[model samples]
Target: MVQHFNFFYDESEHSRKINHSTIVSENYYDNFITTIVGWQTADEKIVLKKYLDFEEKYSDRKSDGELKSTTLKKRQFKNGFASLNRDNIEFILDLFSIFDDNVLLYFSITSKIEYIINQLFLNYKNNIWEDMDMMRYSIVKAIVMYQPEEIISGMYENTGELVQLLKTFFNKRINVNKTNPKLKEHETLAFTQILILLDDINVKFDINWNYDIAFHGFKKYLIEKDISKYSLFLDREGDDGNTLKAAKQVGLTFVTEVDSKEITGIRMADMLVGIISKLLKSLHEELRYDSIEDGLNKKILGEGWFNLNEQQLFLYKQLTHIICEVNNAWYKSFCGIYSDDFIILVSLLNYISSFDTVNEIKAVDKKMHGEHFNAYVCKELESYFGRMESKLPIDPIPGGKKDYFYNQRGAKVFFNSSKQPLLKINEGCNIFNVLSVGFSNDGNAMITISENKNFLCYRLPKELFEWAMTCVAFANRGDNVFPSKVQFTKNGDRYYADVL
Candidate 1:
């Protein structure tokens, strides 16, 4: 049977807004979260009952009201959540028990601003409360959803603006190197890459995507795993033609605008992402603690505020209850630049077990010696676990070797002296190969006569050709050898040749 599942996806992020310039070393709260929860279509009836029961017991709030973590953080809900019947730990436990075997969860978490600044260029709108987050998310979604051609076609009108913004940011006068003398090689490369990304699309369309990279990674993972044929019922954000286009791009067969109040699964997904965002914040703070020995453990062991251990313990327990284990729920980070403080601890869950596991199997071969098994796997696991990559260039040295000729950007000048007149091949003597061994092939040679602007091709015997190749190789290796002239013996007569 092609099992039908209903997936509810939502996002949560930190409420506070901080600009790049305003960030202080002491103030640290930056995280964005995307959550997706799914269950079999047949299990909706029981799921509704579980949510209704919990609401009736603990909250005077109706099922239609928003059950966000921020709203739940109010004194009334917090007090009721800590009541004898429904304490904070038991509340999550109860929610977990409702859909134990029938549900699946996945989430991605990263610093939102960090992701924006590094991945997509930040757009400064007057209102900080504008849908900037959603816009950022949409661009990343579009990046992942369509190829460069498709995106250029879909968003053609914006290309000029994008190009202008890039030019202004990089301070480049022109795109081509032949025209502009002061263009940096890396900047040129970046420009070329952007141009390629904006090249060639005949079709034209538009999309308004409210969810960004959080959903980008989630939908991408689904597409990768071949489990994309699900009914995506998101709590209604807004409907636009772009949403449908994006949905079609990601292989989602059906899309439904769900009411957060009506669908308990949708509301639950909202609550879950919110709580996960909070947990991620706590985890990040724990990671940032400078003096902590066991990095990820300091938070779990509760060296700080009330019930911090309980919070960490309950989060794992509830996750375990939902999917039977905290490690089983798929987790990924979509932020372009990730932090290095806790290299292995950014897996949506704050727990250490959320880190990826590697299987190291050693097999002994009869002919294999000391380095045999090491070469087999090539220390793949060690390399993966050792260091995380940065999105920005790490310690880049400016001004590459390619711009040394005439002090302009072009191919590197290997040999730079002067060229001699062209040497013609003799009649009935076939020209064989064209070798490109030149320190400055810009019509120049390190050893030359009379500063002529031409190069000579000498017809050499096979032995002489081998000698020439050896000499070129040595010259390339920085050996101080330059030929002033050449003389070859022909039929017991010496034929002399000069560079001119």
Candidate 2:
């Protein structure tokens, strides 16, 4: 008689048994199908033929002998395996159906939906649902259970969150690591195709979704912060020369016509520029001053002057002097005064209009663009100094024409020849005195600046085009040089270059 020994099972042993059973079951299933199916299914036969044809077309027989051998072995294995899987032929069919549906959905969303559907029915008739009927059934069941619209709406509400959930679900069912290259590629392709479809749905529904929402939100924030005030002068309709002139005239009339008593103290500062202009014009017409300084002092310090503190009085005098100088200088240089001077004057008026006796001393003169002067006279005067609501009432001077001079090697200078005097290198030929010059990327284009404030662009010559191209590439990547002085500098005796 033999004695029987009993072995006690632990949790680890139980887990091992379960794991082994799963492995055995999978192996058995694979082997069983291999034994049953005799390979050479009509659909797989076609695929194999196509694969062989592609190999023949692209692969050189002499060079790819090793590759061909390996490919042949794989084909033999695939044929043998397919032959053994007769009972599970339906599985192959099911896989085909699932693939077809996925492709259909992808193309449909891409606006090529009709073509994909037609291909599924006409071209893939035999292969459709041939290998994976269970997968096909499951996918169909999912489609029926959850409508496309519902999925789209859910995705719209929380795209990131839903994509994460889908990834988790696929990982659990597929048992493949998401990080695997093949799996990741498939996921990316599928998700991108689905996203294309989602975009179509969003457009059809007239929903303003996606990245633009954030941009619009930012714009709203800027408006709330009063940045829109700066853009007011940029308004095309109201900022024309005629409109600006009318606005200035109206503003001047409004200020001068209203009696000092009728005008609110807060608003008086707003009208200051117009009132001063009118007062100055009157004085210049009726009582000619021997000098500009005397005329300003007489206007502000004389008997009819409004009450002002020491600081206000000082600012008044300073502003008159500054305005007179700017006006005179602009006329002298440009041959005529532009409406730009009026913009500065208006800013000054707004500043003065807000001045109060209590707060006048704290304000200081602030220059506008180095050309015009502005000052804050009082805390109450701050609002009147609001951005010029009116536009310049003049047609902006059209930009000057550019003249380009190119050297044999593609180095070029651009300048407005009509405005600036050019040095004549020959008869009817001029060389621009360029302030700056450089090559753009690819060496084909040259950019230059001239003394007359003009930019020049020219194409490089053909013979040195390649070297010029390289130079351009290098120049684009080089650090920008700010010209301190326009002169020639010699770093070495042989290497002399212009400093810009």
Candidate 3:
């Protein structure tokens, strides 16, 4: 025999209680009859009736303390089921199938039903003069059971039926020009919520939802109130601009103006880079794992393949060296900039390089002792610096080999030139903390190369004097030396300096 179960509120506050004795067993057909009968007796229906009665009685009078207390009492009576065990309640509800006639009654006895009831009571309680809460609870209850497939089927079954039903209900209860201002507002918000839920259900069920109808209804709902006025733009056409504009107009103070287009581009770039980096890391891991597995599973390479194996290892090391070189090139390109965004980007790139480098080195170190791996890394570094030097016009002067002197103001300056009357170069004047050399690409620019901040170029003949003065001022400003890159444009008409 199928066991019957029922969960109802036990109002006794002393302990967790359920009125298990109320359980009733009936045939499937009789169960439906019993459920409808029980719903009539339920506190939700009773409270709803009382709320409608109160609206009728107090239609002329202003809301008073006694009326408010009465409303609160009705609410308490409706919400009395809050003490029921939720899990056991769900178990009892599962007895009714989706197509069962008792399904509506099952939902009526659940938590969501209780919530709707309390809300309706509260709505009418506050505004006794309003006609009604518009029987929204009934509509929502119907929607909850409507299910996505049913709605789709219903839409096809009668084209105008759904819209007619909605129109009739909305027209009867919702007053656009109601004297009770709160009632007008609540109804509008409730309508919007219902529309959103309908959209959600359609999307979840993969139905061919009508965006025009949904948004149009939402727009109409918003026009009824000033606070929800910005919701009008939610249906507006265009890019993300409409949504952003609406957010701003609604006094959504926390939404920031970070240049949506630029932010989106940056985010996409970051995602792409991150994906590539992960792929590279995965490849490296696979190579190392295969090498270890091969060594364990098979015999060591014969003398014929010894040279091939050595060459393969050599090629792998060279590939890593190339990766490092490319990273260095990227670093050099942006090193002259003072922009915080560029700096952050460079930092992240360097971190990715360092992470990969550390892992590769560790893996190689495991295969060979510290000496072979360390020597290989050093050779790669040497090659990198050699390539850098070949590209630069000025050679690096070694420490102690170069002459250092203090000016009349007692500021130290390092000179490679063995000439008298040393020119005073301020810290900011040295682009990327490197001495300014003749401009590259043309005479329209000057370049300063340094490892810490990289290159600084000052563009044009016009801004040279001002750049010089600014550098001198920075020198006189005491201990905090500014490192920057100054670049001159090709026309010599403008000068650009990376000074932050």
Q: Highest TM-score: give the candidate number.
A: 1
- Sort by lDDT, top down from the best: 1, 3, 2
On a 0 to 100 scale, what is the lDDT of residue 45 in model 3? 44
- Flag regions of model 3 displaced more than 4 Å: 1-311, 314-321, 324-367, 370-500
Higher-scoring candidate on lDDT, 1 or 3: 1
Q: Write the per-residue lDDT of candidate 2 for residues 161-206, one digit (tens) a residue.
A: 4434433443342333244546345433443433332232221121
Local distance difference test scores for all models = 0.42, 0.27, 0.28
Error of 2 at 404 (Å): 19
What's model 3's overall lDDT? 0.28
Q: Write the per-residue lDDT of candidate 1 for residues 1-500, one digit (tens) a residue.
A: 55577788777753333333223333334555667777667877676778778766657443445455554442222211222223666666666666566566776656543443333343232122332333333334223221233223323345435434433432332233435434334334544444443343222222322334445665655543346357887666655544344555665668776677777777778877765555545444533433212221212212222112334345454553443353242333344333321122232222322322211111222233223322322344235323221111122112223432321222223332322223333433322223223323342322222124333332243334445555555543334244344433333322322221
Candidate ranking under TM-score, highest first, comes to: 1, 2, 3
Q: What tens-digit string does per-residue lDDT give for candidate 3 at 423-454?
A: 22343333344354333222233323444443
Model 1 TM-score?
Answer: 0.44
Q: What is the lDDT of candidate 1?
A: 0.42
Consecutive 10-residue window with the lowest summed lDDT within model 2: 29-38
